[model samples]
Target chain A: SQQGEEDPQALSIQEGENATMNCSYKTSINNLQWYRQNSGRGLVHLILIRSNEREKHSGRLRVTLDTSKKSSSLLITASRAADTASYFCATVGFYNQGGKLIFGQGTELSVKP
Target chain B: EPEVTQTPSHQVTQMGQEVILRCVPISNHLYFYWYRQILGQKVEFLVSFYNNEISEKSEIFDDQFSVERPDGSNFTLKIRSTKLEDSAMYFCASSEMGGSSNQPQHFGDGTRLSIL
Candidate 1:
């Protein structure tokens, strides 16, 4: 079974709209990170929020973590056509010796111009 | 800015054949990882290497999969027997800190592996 799962597998919106993607995990984690992948490309790290953190922001990206629910969310404000890519949330668990990130099935976003 | 790099932007191999995917992680990074994504699927973690040994691996990383950090610079992921199911975009990533929440990973443009 996948440790993390994202809600709403696909989303489509206009260029200026806001895009929200959510992720839920099964176990405790040390931190959660968000990544973006353009078609045929590698994942680019977006943001990392520690277990103790409630919210974080970077540029147009905003991420929130609710440990009680074992869930997290990524919000992209004023989306652009260039933002048409897949977004994934990865959880770094509490285990020692490694930073193995368990990734959620991504949310495919299509922003039409 | 230093970033991870992978060679042979793409590779195609026959079934039952052996394939070696190479990567050069960031100069100062200590942790290395291998991940893969099948067409339209999420990126899946294969293994993580630190101290020149595998620190963790997923069930998908069976006996056929192995990783090595040869020459202290290049990290490699070798699939002993290629299967059609093994075809995917293989990615390499590195991190400055080892399993610390303060640092995030830096990824490389993946090597597209196509198993025929």
Candidate 2:
């Protein structure tokens, strides 16, 4: 897998079911962020987790980071139809001077209501 | 809510022509960035700017590309002598802080550039 690679490129689930997406990177990162993008639209920041953090939560979204493995998972609980969008994990590498975000290919999620 | 707005949502320019894309970041943002996504490709960073100078730029930002905060309010990306490969969706983003990467960046809807 490449740096900032998200598995399960496409995911479809029932409206009320939980959706889980995973991402992996090959380098040390200062922080990682998840973003949502509807088709032909801009990216919307969802959450961020720092290097030292293990777990973080906001609303129905839960993110977990494991520096030892350079992996992270995002879980959207009780997902709604409106939650359907492409989800991408972006990393700010420790050595990135300008804080540029290195993004993954993204997971295209579909919540069937 | 404060938003980063981009002008000329869609642009079509002839090859070898100079083209400029404009962005107005959120009022209080301190750091500004530009990223581009070729159709069906992942978003790629182009440049980051702060305090009127480019802080960092990717290899993709070649000599043909330039950025300017020409006025206090507008940040522009000018591509001198546009090429067909330059046709992509360009996004402008801003963040409140520059010291840390933990701040979430807000992005504009993007300006789609098409070169003929």
Candidate 3:
């Protein structure tokens, strides 16, 4: 079963613009992580934000988690053509054992040059 | 900068036949996992392995599915009888620590399994 559901199923933007994607999960989570997948490829870890943390940043990627609302968001600043890919948000529930992740449907982002 | 690696980027098998997907996780990692994604669908967790044993598995993981470390560096997922619905991209992942540690998982490029 999937715990998260990402909003904005698809987004298109010009290079240098910013892209924001949101995710909402059903249960309390220990951590929320974001990943990117290029076409026909495996997932690439982007960043991880613990439930105790409100926000985190890595390079152009910023992730914010709100446990009270059971939602999280990913913001990619100054997007590039290479940034075109599908982004997913995965959650590890508080009671989940063995760290099994429940992933969201994902948002497909397209950046044009 | 080590990364997980998977073999046979793509595999085509007939229904009812068996298929094996292989992976070599980063050295020194302790936790291993397998996930599958059907085209246009979300990635779904199949199983998690630690201490050379299965620690967790999802409902989708049934009797037809099994995993093994096999050797020091190799992890493999075997399907006894492939079904048409079983066709999907299979990914292998590993982490430096177990789920309680909050460590992120590293994933391989994935094997595209097509059951014809």
Candidate 4:
């Protein structure tokens, strides 16, 4: 079973607008990370928020995590046409063996000019 | 600026035939992983290798899938028998922290495998 799952499988927005994508996971995790994929290409790491951290920011990306809710959200501000891509949330479970990322069904975002 | 690199950007094979997807992770990275994304589906974890052995694998990684770090720089994923359903973009990733909670894994461009 997948540990992380995203909501609103697809999202559409206009350039300069803000887009929010949500994710919910089933297990306790050490961190939650977001990734971006352009078309069928490999994933690009976006941001990672640790369990001890509630939020983080990088450029136009903002990510928030709530361990008690087992949920996280990715917000892209001032979206651009180039921001069009699929977004995925992955969970890094809290374990010593090695943290494995279980990916969620990605949300495809299309930014129209 | 270092990034993961995958060979043979695209590969086509007949069903029941064998195929190997290769990758070279970032230098100085200790952890490696393979994930696949079928058309119109979420990316799925196939396996993770560390210390020259598989530390974890998903259910989707069954008897057909195998991973190897043949040398110091190369990591390979092999499917013994190609199946049409196995067609997907396979991505190789590496991280410096060995899956520590604080680091993010870097990914390769991916190898598109088309099983005929």
Each candidate's DockQ: 0.71, 0.70, 0.82, 0.71
**Candidate 4: TM of chain A?**
0.95
Off by over 4 Å in 2: B99-101
Better of 3 and 4 by lDDT: 3
Please write out the lDDT profile of model 2 over residues B1-104, one tens digit for every residue: 99999988999999999999999999899899999999988889899999999999989999999999988889999999999999999999999876264789
User: Over the stretch A1-68, how does candidate 2's per-residue lDDT look in tens digits?
Assistant: 23667989999999999999999998998899999999888999999999999999999999999999
Which candidate number maximizes lDDT?
A: 3
The candidates score, on chain A by TM-score, as follows 0.96, 0.96, 0.97, 0.95
Q: Which stretches of candidate 3 lie over 4 Å from their true place?
A: none
Candidate 4 local lDDT, B2-81, one digit each (tens): 99999989999999999999999999988999999898887888898989999999898999999999999999999999
Candidate 3 lDDT by residue in tens digits, B4-112: 9999899999999999999999999999999999989999999999999999998899999999999999999999999999999999999998766888999999999
Off by over 4 Å in 1: none
lDDT of each: 0.90, 0.92, 0.94, 0.90
For model 3 chain B, the run of ten residues with the poorest summed lDDT: B95-104
Q: Is candidate 1 or candidate 3 better by DockQ?
A: 3
**lDDT digits (tens) for residues B1-116 of candidate 1:** 78899998999999999999999999998899999989878788899998888988989999999999888799999999999999999999999876654578899999999988
Model 1 per-residue lDDT at B32: 92
TM-score of each: 0.96, 0.97, 0.98, 0.96
Native-referenced DockQ of model 3: 0.82
Candidate 3 residue-wise lDDT at B13: 99
A1-113: candidate 4 lDDT, tens digit per residue: 53756888999999999999999998878888999999867899999999889999999999999999999999999999999999999988777356678899989999999
